[model samples]
Target chain A: MALPLVIDIAIGQLRRRKRQSIVSIMGVALGVGFFIAVASLMQGFQQYFVSQVIDIAPHIVIKDEFRTPAVQPAVAAFAEGAVAVRGVKPRDEIRGIRDARGKLAALEAVPGLAAAPTLRGPVILRYGARDHSVALVGVEPERERRVTNIEKDMIAGRLEDLRATANGVILGIGAADRLGAGVGDIITAVSPRGVAVTMKVVGLFSTGLTALDQGEGYALLKTVQILQQRPNVVNSIRIRLADITQAEPLARVIEARFGYRTESWEETNSNILSLFIIQNAIMYSVTGAILLVAAFGIYNIISTVVHEKTRDIAILKSLGFTEGDIARIFSVQGFVVGAIGAALGCLLGWALIEMLAAIRFDFNNPVLRGQRGFIMSRSALPFIFAGGFALVSASAASILPARRAARLNPVDIVRGAA
Target chain B: MSAPPLLEARGVTRILPGEGFGAPPVRLVEDIDLTVGAGEFVAITGPSGSGKSSLLYLLGLLDRPSAGAVLIDGEDTGALSAPALARLRLARLGFVFQFHFLLPEFTTLENVMIPMRRLGRHPQDEIRERARAILASLGLQDAERKLPEQLSGGMRQRVAVARALANDPEIVLADEPTGNLDTRNAATVFDVFARIVGEHGRSVIVVTHDLDLAARAGRRVHLVDGRIVSDGPHSPVVPQAVA
Candidate 1:
């Protein structure tokens, strides 16, 4: 039989049960719509969180610590346990990267990478009668700006003031608030090694992370090295890359070359990323269940149609329609419903997303201070996925009924009718 | 002997399997041999449960015989595949049932066009024109656009006849085509069947309980207990061919 005739009969049958067909179509449409809406909402927040992490954190961090402790010369030389070495005394060494300048130069020469050195140590800031402990990081102002977002986070004095003014420091807004200090305030900073210095605060910045904002401060490398009594020593090298996804591979290369431990941002935030996976699984499974339920509606209506039109089926069979043609006729009804439902679903999903985007939350929480409304993704992937899923499910639901209709023996029906 | 019969059944038998395990099967029809020639109108008369419709179904290729073979135009149909049989039916045969089972959703015209469209032998416009002509020949030209429910019983049966002739098949098999109609409507339906054989030179096999209707056919076959009891002209002489 010609395909157009089959489609014509399929459409005619659907029109006969107009109300049931519309209901089944609406079920499919709602399933796809909610799938798109929920997917967009979840993915939008996830992308936002990822972007924030990428912007505020170094893509790769090369620490002063080695990946493995040094082995004794005897242990290396002796042939496979022939000589057992025990309790070897270790030599004292400085706790910092030994050829920081050479390593930084090598990293900076690579394309699309920025490297900066920092000396980080603990210190106590005393202003008036109050004292707060903070991690004092020593950095070169020009290189640090390229590797971090400190310049953009500055609320008061500029980062370059650390080079212009002698003994200037940049304090985190939370740290400064606890110390009751502001820019240009002269404060005493006492290092763990008992060395003390009077520092002038030049800038205040907030990074939105509670730990960093409350317990970190930045100053020039010279001043911090002197205060920590570890002159000419840099403890860490932070790297920023043009493509942040390259962090893991580049970190491995740097670690292998330098014999130091390296960490990528993905590894550092693996817990949260894994949580996103669970969130996505839950989202898809829930939406899939809804689509499956909608598919049952298609199944119910088609089965009822087959039962009600037994005589018509018998007549069609006797008129020379093959079993395959009968199957195609019924399957085409499902295809038509699925196609129309998917199209309407995409539009409904877009409308739902827009409605969600318009809803504003009135809350005083600092974490949500800048967000005006719900985060929603506008990418086309969710719409396509939901529509495609709905179409497949709806078509699958029709196969059983179509097969049953096709297998009906016309002889029995016609004789029974007589 | 002028030409091989249009349809021939050789000792055909059909058994319906029993419902439970180890139960004996029941025979719907057994050892029935029949032949229908082109341009001959034959009526099958039988009492209830005598398998008149079963014989017609076997002749129409709607049911497979268990013990014997049915042939169409001297071609044995037992070896053909299901799809091949359906194609043969599409090209060479048509059927009407006791009930006017016109697709309720389609108009009279579209109902008639179904078989021609299924055959796909002609362009759509030609099929439409041919379907209109057939309906007009059956006195249903004014009822072309009306749905089956809108028409009277006789009109619907006539529409069914028009649909049966859509592909211009060599044979039209109708099972109790006018069983539910009044005397006038039954006469109209029988007249349409007579015209199909006489005017178009097509064979028609009808199953009916009414012997008066059977008496009008060129040949009559009577069945009892799934076996033919008589096979001859209903009158003392066979009806002469029309034109």
Candidate 2:
């Protein structure tokens, strides 16, 4: 038969059995939906995880295989060489929260370089007998504005207030609210080394970001360095590069020259990243099982169709339909069903995603890293899942039925009661 | 014209092995020689269990004859590959069954269009025109678009007749085309067959238990216990019918 006529015949056959055709399509759609759901969730987890890793470290990081002070001298040398390389890191460090003055000044001013040291630590604060521990950071008033968005989070006080007071601290609005401290309230902090200091809450900030807005305090870097008893030494050197994603290579260059251990942003949170990968693998595998079951359902429906049409097959054969044509007719039916199911499933998956996003579903499953809840699926995984599931189910559904149709004894079916 | 008959067979034996282990082989249709010629309408008659259907199947290439040779247009069927055999069947053979074996899912038009599609050529309008013409010839012009399920028994059998002629086959092999019809319906099916063989110049071999229908053919071949008992010109009414 002409190929298009074969398709027409196949499609007409399906139209005749409208209910059966619809059920088969639904079977494929369910299979695809399950697959897409798993794929979307897996993809969301990956994005959340990869970003977290990037949040803490650079796009790439290279550390000394060993993490010990035994290589301290080589570490310094590695740091110096990394600084010597051109286009290595950004010429400025915007550690806006706090500044580590005397400790970071000399290293940052090294010619052909851009670096800054900011005070980053936690402090204990007491308000009317209620004491809570919160993170405290000190930044250079002028240079801090370049890198970070801390200044944009001014709740009530001004940046001039931070520059004017000798003992001034900027508090995250959440932290200040919990402490019941206004912009002019006084707070006390004790350094890790047993040194105590008191500072006025001259400025309040709110970034509207969860991590930065709660339990955080900022002060002048020089004042922080003095209080912490690290006059010329900073806790961590923050590096920005011409290409942020090139941190691993940059860290490698620095580590190679200075012999110091370095870590990229990705490596900083490797555990959660591994967790995301593992979850995706598991979820897709589960979806595969669902697809298998759905395919099985489709197979069952098609098998019935083949059995019911035995007499029709005999007539077609007797009328000169080659075995290939018979098989193709049925296969065409399956392909149409699968394609339709996949298309519908795609729409359904998108609708479900929108519905989920609307509800702000929290995927706070402890197994997921960072307790993150809402994530949007933004990859080809959804289409792949739906299309893959439909294709596999559709083709699989046709196999046995098509074979049966091909193998039928035309004489027997035609002569015998069908 | 100088070659073998349009259909020629020699010692056509078919032995089917019983399924899986130890069951003895069953002789389904054995040592049968049958022939029909151009422009001839022959009828094969037998009691049930006489392998009348099996013999027709062997001739039609619906199933392979287990042993022996059957030639169509002088081409030995045994030597052709399965696909080649299928092609041979498509190119030359047509079939009608006791039941109206029209595809219930398709309309009478599509049923007629099937064999034409197997031709795999000709435009849509041409195919449709031919199918409509065939259905019209069968006096089923208005019902061509009606599904087989919607057709009456007589109409359905007429549709089957049209389908058998769709490819313009040299021979139409029917296994009891009228076994399920009433007397009138059976006579109507026979009437359609007579016109097809007479006007179209194509041969037809119908298997029937109905004596009236058998008597109407150009010749009659009788089978009993897997053997041909009588082969003759159409009738018990003709004294030389068994000669």
My TM-score estimates for the predictions, one after another, are 0.94, 0.83
Worst 10 residues of 1 chain A by lDDT: A363-372
Instruction: Give the candidate number with the greatest TM-score.
Output: 1
DockQ of 1: 0.67
Across residues A1-418, which tens digit of lDDT does each residue of candidate 1 receive? 2448999999999999899999999999998999899999999888887877787778898898987887778878874777777887767678999899999999999999999999999999999999999999999989998998988878899999999888999999999999999998999999999999999999999877667878999999999999999999999999999988799999999899998999999988999999999999999999989889989988898899889989999999999999999988888888888888888888989999999989988874444436777789899999889899888888898899999999999988987887
- Identify the candidate with maximal lDDT: 1
Q: Write the per-residue lDDT of candidate 2 for residues A1-418, one digit (tens) a residue.
A: 3457678778877888899889878877776765776577667767765654344322433222335534344456787564433444443543232233432364355433334456566678776676766777766666555434466657677766778987898888778877888888888877776777888988887655445556778888777877777664455555544455666666676566555466666566668667877887787777777767767766776688788888878777766677888888787777888888887777777776666556543554433433445575767768875686678678778887988898787877765772
Where does model 2 exceed 4 Å of error? A1-3, A30-115, A119-135, A141-143, A152-161, A173-179, A205-216, A241-244, A278-290, A360-375, A378-381, B19-21, B234-243
What's the DockQ for every one of the candidates? 0.67, 0.52
| lDDT, residue A35, model 2 | 70
Model 2 chain A weakest 10-residue run by lDDT = A56-65
TM-score of chain A of each: 0.92, 0.74
Model 2 DockQ reads 0.52
Report fnat, model 2.
Answer: 0.60
Estimate the lDDT of model 2. Answer: 0.73
